[model samples]
Target: MATVLLAVLVAGGVGCALVVCLLWRFHRALDRTPPDVGAFAHSAATRTAGAAAARTSSARMTNLTSALPWAVPLGTSVADSCRTEDRNPFLGPASWAPINCVRSTVFYLAFDGDIRTHLRQLDAVLAEQEWVGSGSSLNTLTGMATWLSQAGGDPSPAASQQGSTEPPGSRPICLSTTYGPATQKRAVPHGGLGLRLQVAVAELPCTPSAETGDLQTDGRPEKSPVEGTVYLTWHPLSTDTVSRSAYTAHRYVAALSLVDGYAVQSTSTTAPPSPLTR
Candidate 1:
């Protein structure tokens, strides 16, 4: 009877030990497996990841549009003082200002002739501020030269230095917004385009807006993605060339689109300089 009792006791102890060992092994396997992918990230980490993704997507739009000629990044990268929301003293509710502006490359898709004749003609109709080339005063580009930016209220110092004076064929002549106001400014918003013409004295007639169909004469897309529309008729041009027809008159109209984008951002208080300021 004593031996049987002792044997029962021993069996009970062994069973308990086995159960404890199995439980520990089960816990070890669970720890070895990867954690739930979602729960592992903290809230701050998740937020940062989301913001980075959003920025990446937005940056793509800027990149795709960069293919357009005379394209520039929209920021106060110039002078460092020129801010995105620089206040304009002349017009505004709060005297709001624009910190940055973007202008397209002034290219004449099909000029009447080579750069010289075209510059002379364009200048005649254009105000002294209106030019036909590029200037490095703003930001230099490859192949073509650079030009100064236009601030409607007060022209910057760099603006005076730029004009049609640059080596004509070397780059497009300089043009400014002080020209025939909205209509002319929109035509050559940045400057003039750099012509790669081997043929001088070529004739490409202008039609109603862009209707004359010079841009379409070749493989070029009728409407430009940058300038859009064929003509810069103050607004959008209906055709590709200026109208020489008696009914349309012989006025030389600049054909282009709005180089200045959006309604234009009004000036607001800055978000404060970075803490690690120089």
Candidate 2:
């Protein structure tokens, strides 16, 4: 009996050791995942919205790190990449204020072009990269499209016209949201955590229609060429432990705007042009 008891104790001790090792590894993983919001802030400030959005978004991401400890895994490689471009005022000698904001690129998509085609192409390019999420939801795509439509400002009269072939005033742009597999609990609310990526395309009003004499031979108003911005966001979602009944999602850790086109041009070196500029 004593021998059996000793054997049981030994097994229990071994089990405890194993559990401790697992806990250590888990915490280590969490440590690796904290996002470098500083990097995101520096990059975002170079865009059209200016540094305000960057500052706000970076603060939100920092808050999220405190909540969702394992949301964004900034592995050694990613951290190194961020450090290489670390332009944080708190850390660096350079000021946080932007010196010169320049237009990065501009491209025009045909008014009636297949936006989904471009989105799919962009998706392909993203898929080739290491940071992108593996899982995709059609529902998320639908949600993004709706959000873009509302955010793009009031729909033109053409959009209001029923059964219109040209999507009323503007063309349809595609948006996609992709997510990575959750490393912790399931992605479902209650107790889930993971990384999310959102990409959206939208048309910008360039030259006024009247200025460009945008009319077809049939006297129908020709829709303006679609000049749009490609918006990219990285954020995290997590369930609240205190209120297990609900979830808490965080703001974007990184948000970037890129002009879409075969050739990108900077219109000005002194100030960034409006994202809508063609």
Candidate 3:
């Protein structure tokens, strides 16, 4: 009876040790597992935000292009060619320039105000000009209004704040127009207008503020102010005919810089080759 009791006690002790060992192993495995929950969540949120921003930017660009319908057909083709060439050697400038080529003109307007408001003002300014368009012809004013209406609402607050200040009214806005005359149109095999114009806007880095004190006196680096640019291009359509002359082929460009809600720098130029006799 004593031997049997000793054996039973030893077996029970061994079983308890095995159970403890298994529990320890399980705990160690859990500890080795990757803790990526927070990282994964952050990555997903960043991707979503990036996609949203891209879409907003694209929409704004499209609206800007649509504002000038007469220039769209030709400008789009040239812009596409440029983008393509930039990506691949499929199309060279020599081959692209002569095709439906026309003398083009680009115009720029820069000011300090809300982007939407500035666009509206630009539309009004263009409407006052007789060379933009007439009855049954492409009207820049109507085109701008239509594009704005289709855009639905105001630009996203985040978009408006890209390196820009708050209070949307204080943001700098730039407008550009590229005009080409029918005289610059390239003859097409088919009977149709072969005209082209292109416009683009880019946000450039701002200039750094000038440091007042010596480097030893001021250990911190000076922060640069935010700045951006708006680019525009114009081209004649491949099919457009050289009928009656309208605007000149000369480029009209303007630039404006604002400081403390005031125009600090303003410059404008209209190139040679005066407008046609109208």
On lDDT, the leading prediction is 2
Q: Where is model 3 poorest over a 10-residue stretch in terms of lDDT? A: 257-266
Query: What is the C-alpha local distance difference test score of candidate 1?
Result: 0.27
How accurate locally, in lDDT, is each candidate?
Answer: 0.27, 0.31, 0.28
Q: After superposition, how far is residue 183 of candidate 2 from its true place, in Å?
A: 9.7
Clash totals in order: 30, 5, 11
Ranking of models by TM-score: 3, 2, 1
Q: How much lDDT does candidate 2 score?
A: 0.31
Worst 10 residues of 2 by lDDT: 75-84
**Across residues 92-186, which tens digit of lDDT does each residue of candidate 1 receive?**
22222332222222122322223344434333432232333333322211111123212222222222222423232232233322212322223
List, residue by residue over 28-118, the lDDT tens digit for candidate 3.
5542322222232234432343234334324433554455433312221111100000111132211111111011222222222233444
TM-scores vs. true structure, each candidate: 0.19, 0.23, 0.24
Superior by TM-score: candidate 1 or candidate 3: 3
> Model 3, residue 59: what's the lDDT?
46
lDDT-wise, the better of 1 and 2 is 2
Number of colliding residue pairs in model 1: 30
Q: What lDDT does candidate 3 reach at residue 26? A: 62
lDDT of 2 at 5: 100
Residue 148, model 3, lDDT: 42
